[model samples]
Each structure stands twice: as structure tokens, then as C-alpha cells.
Target: MKNQKAVLVILLSNVFIAFLGIGLIIPVMPSFMNIMHLSGATMGYLVAMFAVAQLVMSPFAGRWVDRFGRKKIIILGLFLFGVSELIFGLGESVPVLYLSRILGGFSAAFIMPGVTAYVADITSLKDRPKAMGYVSAAISTGFIIGPGIGGFIGEYGVRLPFFFAAGIAFAACILSAFILKEPLSKEKLAELANNQAQSNFFYDLKKSLRPLYFIAFLIVFVLAFGLSAYETVFSLFSDHKFGFTPKDIAGIITISSIFGVIFQLFLFGKLIDLLGEKKLIQLCLIVGAVSAFLSAVISGYFAVLAVTCFVFLAFDLLRPALTTFLSKAAGEEQGFVAGMNSTYTSLGNIVGPAIGGILFDVNIHYPYLFSGVVIIVGLLITVIWKEKQFSQSLAK
Candidate 1:
């Protein structure tokens, strides 16, 4: 138990560093677009390209994690992440940027599923919610710190943030190479090995993820889709609508990240215990939809900021709640389920940015309006979802 706890700490640190590297690039993306003289649609495609690569690779990555162990996959992912960021920092042309995003997506496919499965391997069912909460908090913390730091560093140059992110990711890769150990028990490892040996990846994946699990995956997709649509073009919207610079955008994101960290670390577990995952998910979806809608119509900076805070808080609450629910329903296929979750997320990311970019070209308000509508549809699905099987599985 003590050993598991120790490993969990290391896993949490890795997630923090990984997310930090990713977040460092967010605030600078608009600047990069400007430097390249890219259109809104082009920018959206650039963002989506990363997820496109991730969607293609996630299924295979998940299977490999279960087969090869988590540590090895994480190391490889971090190395790729560092290389991709470095390429983006140094690249001179649009094709090189696309290549960078492709590598970044591939890196995400490995890192996200591996970290999720690693957490599941080490934590007990009762402790899983809190563990997931901590993981979310770590991710939020990275995002919280990343943009502010990135913005400050970006004062030097747009490419500086990417280079800085590369440095952090490379350092994390080295740290993880030495510190991270496989968290699965020998019995559990043998079970996974035997399962892999008996069946092919697709067969096992299809068999493991039941119908209810598909619904869970769908929910994750909708959440990611809406959020990505809003996020991918957010800086563009703010810059156009409010005459905000990169520094101002960075400040807004920093505030949002602060609220996200607070909610994830302190309120998420308590809220889950109070409302249950079903009710919590439903409530958050409604909140997200309303906030997105309000942000679209509102005029002033403060009103926008206030509404966005609610949006960020809702997203923060929803992530850990939904992840815990999915992890509970995963049964013995933790790695595969986590991979599927990442796959669905990547799909949303791909579609969301593509749609958002086109909409942004037409009208600045369209992306937020579209995001709100999609989230409402997601809410309706969640409201009608039959959770009996999910509940029964979690009870075990």
C-alpha cells in the first residue's frame, strides 16, 4: 500500500509536468497564427491536426500500454512530446507546423491513456475518486501556472514559449525515465498478459467495452468537442471582440485555470458524494451550456470573464466526475477503457476545431453559439441515459 502511494506521487508529478508543457503553448497559439499570417480556418486546422493524429493512434497506444507496461509508454510519449515542441519552436513553414502537431497528437495518445491506466492500477475502488481528483488538480495546476509563465516568457518571442515547453518536457522525460516504475501487481500483470495472449486487440476491445461504456465514451466526446470548439478560437474571439493582446488572453486563462484548480482539488470529491455522478454530470452540462451562451451575447470584459469562470468551473467539475464514473465501469480493462476515452476525446477535438475555425471565419459569435447548442444536446443525452448497469458495476 505504501509503495502504491509512493508510485502514485510519481505518476501525479508526471501528469503535472506533461500538462504543464501542453498548457505552455496555448497562450502563444494566437501569436503563432499571427506570425504565420494564418486565417481562422487555417488556425483551426492546425489545432485539429494534433487531435487527428491522436485519434488515429489512441487505440493502438492503449493496447500497447496494457501489453508493454505503463512506464515504457510514458517515457516514449514524453520524448516525442519534447521533440514535437522543439520542432514547432524551430519550424519556419506551415508544413513543419502541421508535422509538429501530428507528432504532438501521437505523443498525447500515449501519455493520456498511460497516465490514466497507471492511476487505476495503483488505487483502490474507494480511493479512486480522490485519486482522480488529485490527478485533475495536478493537470489544472499545470494549466494554471503554464499560461502565466508562458505569457511572461512569450514577451521575448512567440517561439520562446514552445522552446521553453520543450525544455520542461525533456526534463520530465529524464525524471520519469529514472523514477517511474510499473504500478501493476504481478497477478494483475499476468491477467493482462494472458488476456492479450488469448485475444487480438480489436476483439478484446470490442468485448470489453459494452454498450453502456459506449455511452460514457459519447459523453466524453461531447464534452471535449464543445470545450475544444470554444477553446481553439477563444483567443481569436477575444482579440477581435475586445482588442485583447496575448498578455490579456493569458491573464484570462490564468484566472480560469485558478478556478479550475480550486474546484478540482477541493470541491469535486465533496460534490460527487453529495450529488452523485449522474446528477453532477447533468448539472455541469447545463452550467456549461448556459455559460457558453452567455459569453457569446455578453459585451463587457468583466461579464465575459465572470461567465467564463463558471464555464471553467463546470468543466473542471465534470472532468473528474466523468472520469471516475468511467473508471468504475471499466472493470478489468482499465488501459483499454482509458484509451477509448482518449480516442473519443481526440475525435471531438478534431471535429470541434475544424467546425469552430470555419464558424469563426463567418462570425466571431458563431463558435460560442455552436458550443452551447452542442453541450445542450449532450445534456439531453445524459439526462436520458440508463445508468443501471453503470451503477451496478460501480457497486462492486
Candidate 2:
């Protein structure tokens, strides 16, 4: 394969492994909590705690990825992820499981930004949306296979899937050490260093403080928020709202993952190019808000599944475009931009479920309604933020 293609494969490999770990846990989380005798609120706490850790570390990790290098951070993240998986696999109780997720969240703080930063390093501006689409596709593929494997293994034992997940991370770490090279070289390093000396970190930092990045930041936050909110309470919703079994919930997610894969791989690239990133984002948020609201009203498993799948389709379509737009707006500071965005996303994760839990306490449908409102805010932001105008300025 060519150099760019090779880079693409390695980055995608990294993303697939990273998400596999997540997929391994997700299918079993509700069941696992039950076996350990945890309450619904405690389960929500478990999910929020992880996001809290990620929010705390994201900015620092992102800055380091920019200043030091993507290679080291990627390696470091993989190692931590491997360790976290092992901890999860060995855990005999809820506290141990909580501890493991904390470690996993920290690992993600490095891994996610590191992977995207590396992709940004290698891909050209023109090809970036497509490259990011590939990354999203890799995530979808991982979710497809990982959950299937996890759901199968979950029948035997939940812990088994975690062990398998750790092994995948270890294999990815080995590949990273051997197969991937620093895409940015010595000349780029010198340029970075010279530029770093003259560049005002504070001034540049101040620029990212504008309303545009803030709005973009909020968009990601709401995306994460809406998703996490639903995910935290979904199993309960499946049981109480529709009288659906856990297996049925898994099937719903599986079907949605199929749609997500198709959207990301087949439609995402074209949508971004055709509509531009800003328009696509606006469209996605509007569709997502409607879907979430509709999902809350639906009672049958099939109706719920179809609505959720449609929502995920829009989401998968939006992701690459959003990432590309955010990266472009970050100016020369990819790491900082990625980090701040990730942090806001983490904050959404932190708040979304907490709010969902509260709403779930009152009424199951309320969480979805609240989620729709959050996405509405995201939609408004996308409209107001002029991504094309921003990119043209960068070109000048």
C-alpha cells in the first residue's frame, strides 16, 4: 500500500481497538451492574465518573500531544487501556469495576485525541473529511464486531469479553510500536519549535476562546450528552417502557450499528462534500432532536429500534464533518483544539447522564425530551457558526 493508505490503516486499527474495549463493556453493563447488586443511580454514577476523569485530563493530554508528539501519546494510551482492561477483567465487585472505568477514561483521554491528531497530521485539508469518515467507519466496524462478540461471550460470562478486549489492545499496541512512524518529521519539528518560540500560546489560546469555538464546543457537548444520557438509561427504558428483554435491547443496538456503519462509510463522505460541514451538522442535530423525541413516544421494540437507528444514521453522518470543521477552525493548533473539544464532550458525558438519571426517576420519556432540547441548542450553534468563511480565512 502507499504511505497515505498505510497511515490510514494504522490509524483505523488504533480506533478499532480503542472502541472494541468500549463495545466489550457496553452490552453487559446493565447486567453486570445487576450481578454486582448496584442501583440505577449507582450505575449512572459509574458512567458519569468515567466522563469526569476524561474531562479533567483531556486539555492537558491534548496539549501534550501537540507539543511533544502523537507517537508517544498513542503508545502511552494503548498501554493504559490494556492495563484498564485487565483490571476490569479481574474485578470481582462494583468498586473494582468503578476503579477500572476510571483508568479506562484516563486512557481514552490520551487515545482518542492522539488518534485524531495523528490523522490530522497525515491527511490534507481537502481529503480530511473523507479520512475522518474512515475513522468513524472503523469505529462502526468495531462496534459491529465487538458487541456481537461481547453479547455472545456475555452469555457465558461478562468477564470473558473484557479479557478478549485487553488482548486486542495489546495487539494494537504492538502494531503501533512496529508499523506506525511519525508522520511529522525533523523539519516539521524545527518549524514547530521556531514557531513555538514566536507564537503566543496565550494569544492563540485566547483566540480559541471565541464564540465560534465555544459554540462548536457546545455542539459536541450536546452530542455526547444526548447519547450518553440515552445510553445510561436505555436498558431501563427498554425494560420498563416497551417490556423488551435485554437481548432485544442488544438487537436494537446491533441493528443501529449496522445503519451507523452504512451511513459512515457510504454516505458520510458524500454528505459533507455536498452540503458542507456546517449544513450537515445543522441537519444532523435537527434530525437527531426529532428522533430522540419520537423515540420517547414509541412503545414497540421495532418502532424504538427504527427511530434509534435513524438517529444514529444522522449522527454517523455528522461526525466526520464536525471533526473536520473543528480541526480547521483550530488554526495551527490541532492538539489544543481537539483537546478543548474533547473536554466539552466529556463535560456533556458528565452532565447528560446525571440529568438523564434524574429525568428517568421522574419519567423515562423525559430524558429523551431533554436530550432533544440539548440537540436543538446544538443545531442553533451550527447555523450561527460560519465554517466555510472560517476555512477560507485559513486558506488566506
Candidate 3:
């Protein structure tokens, strides 16, 4: 039991470090834009580049987690994360920035699946949800805390936060290499090797189109899309519209994350039990869509904070609700399902920020209003989704 608890700690730490790398650069993006004399479109593309890299790397990374073992893959991912942060900090050229984002995305693709599969490999079924919640919190809280750190760090030097991020990521990578162990037994590794056809990314991507999974995957995509649209341009938007600085953006995001953490810890499982994943998903979409639209019109920093907190709250709930829904359906095919989940998420991340950035270039408020429209489309899909019979079919 002690060993099990220790392993969970390592897994959560790995998850947190990976996401921290993502949040570390967000608040400082406006600074990067100014330094490069770039536009909102470029900022959006920069964010998309990471997703593009993750999209490209996820399939191979999924395969490697099984073939190479989880511990090794995580170390490789952390090493890449540290290097990516270093590049983004020091590199002056626009192309170099893109390269850093892509590398960072590759690190995310590698780390998430490795950590997730490792958690499942070690935890008992009864304790899985609790363990998974901690992992999810680590993921969300890491990203939330990152912007605050970056924002404050940016006060020192716009580029300093990245260096700090790199140093921290490297430390984690070293710790992981020395401390983490493979969770899977040798017999299980051999079993997974022989069953590659079942867990392969290509196979899962192809199967993701089944009516039941397709609707759920669509929800995931829309959630990613809407959230990215709101977030990628947020610092830029607040900077332009409200004349807010990196410090302000950091504080707002920090407060928003607190609300999300509250919901995630105290309310998440109870809501799942009471309302079920499907109903909770639909409720979150409504809140998300409303908040997205509200953000467009809200004045004053505090008002914006309130709306942003609700937006964060909706998305925070939406992610886990959908994850639970998918996990139950995944059954023996968790590996494949995870890859497909990342694929859909990456596709949404790639498109949303690209489009949101373009729209922001045209008009600062368009992205928020546009994000609302996109999420409403998702809510409509949930409204029409009729999965009761399909779920029963799987039972038989």
C-alpha cells in the first residue's frame, strides 16, 4: 500500500510537470509578440504549432509507452519539455519560436499517455477514480498556477519565466529518471506486445467514428475548440481591450483556477453520481457557452474575472465528465481510447486557436462571440445524442 501511494505521487508529479510547461508561457505571450513585432494571428499559430506537433507525435508516443515502458517514456518527455522551454526563452527568430512550441507539444503527447497508463497499471479498481482525480487536478492546477508564476516572473524579464520553467522541468526529469519505476509486470508487457493490433492508434482512430463514440468524441473536440479560442488570445485580448498587463492576466487566471479546483475536488464525483456524465456535460456546455458570450460584453476587470471563473469552472467539469463517460466505454481498450482522445483534442486545439487568432486580428471581441457559437453547436449535439440503447448494447 505504501508503494502504491508512492507510485501515485510520482504519476501525479509527472502529470503536473508536463502541464506546467504549457501554462508557463501563456501570460508572457504578449511580451513575445511585442519583442517580435508580431500580431495576434502569429500568437494563435504559435499555440497551434504545439498541437500540430502533438497531433503528429501522439500515435508513435502511444506505441512507445507500451514498447519502451512508461518510466522511460516519461523521462524522455520531461527532457524534451525542459529543452523546449529553454529554446522558447533564448531563441529570437520567429521560426525558432515555432520550433519550441512544436517540441513542447511532442513532450505533452509523450508524457500524458505515459503517466495515465502508468496510473491505471498500479491502482486498484476501487481507488482508480480517486487516483485519476488527483492526476486530473495536477494537470489542471499545474497549468493554472503556471500563468501566475509566468506573469510574476515576466515582471522581472519577459523571457525569465521560460528559463525558470526549463530549470524546474529539468529537475523533474532528473527526479523521474532516478526515482520512477515501471508499473507493469513482465507478463503484462508481453501481453501488450502481442496485442498491439488492439491498442494501435490507427486502429483506434478508425474506430472512433462509431455512432456512440463519435458523439462523445465530438463533445471533446468542441470543448477543446471553444476553450482554446477563449484562452489562446486571452492575454492578447485583455492587453488590447482593457490595457491589462501580464501581472493582471496572471492574477485573473489564478483566481479562475481556484474556482475550478473547488469544483473538481468537492463537487465533481458527487455531480457525476447525481446527474451522470451526459447531463453534467450538457450543463457545462450551457455554462461555457453563456460565459463565452458574457465575456465579450463584460466591462471592468472584476466582472471579467467572474465570467472567466465560470468559464473555467464549466470547462473543468466538462473535461472530467467526458473523460469518465469515455473511460467507462473504453473497457479493455483504454490505450487506444486515450490515443483517440488526444487525437480529437489536438485537432480541436489546432483549429480553434488558428481561427480564433485570425478572428482576433480582425476584431478583438470576435473570438469570444465565435467561441460561444462553436460551443452551442456542441450543446446541440448533446441534446440530440441518444446513447442509452447503444450503451446497453455494449453491456450485452
lDDT for residue 100 in candidate 3, whole number 0-100: 95
Q: For every model shown, what is its TM-score relative to the native structure?
A: 0.96, 0.92, 0.95
Write one digit per residue (lDDT tens) for candidate 3, span 50-85: 889988888777777776688888899899999999
Worst 10 residues of 2 by lDDT: 196-205
**Model 1 agreement with the true structure over 341-385: per-residue lDDT tens digits:** 888899899999999999999999999999999999899888667
Highest-scoring model, lDDT: 1
Ranking by TM-score: 1, 3, 2
Q: Which residue segments of model 2 deviate by more than 4 Å? A: 190-206, 386-396
Candidate 1 Cα misplacement greater than 4 A, ranges: 185-190, 198-205
Superposed by TM-score, candidate 3 places the C-alpha of residue 206 at a distance from the truth, in angstroms, of 1.2
Off by over 4 Å in 3: 197-201, 387-390, 393-396
Residue pairs with clashing backbones, model 2: none
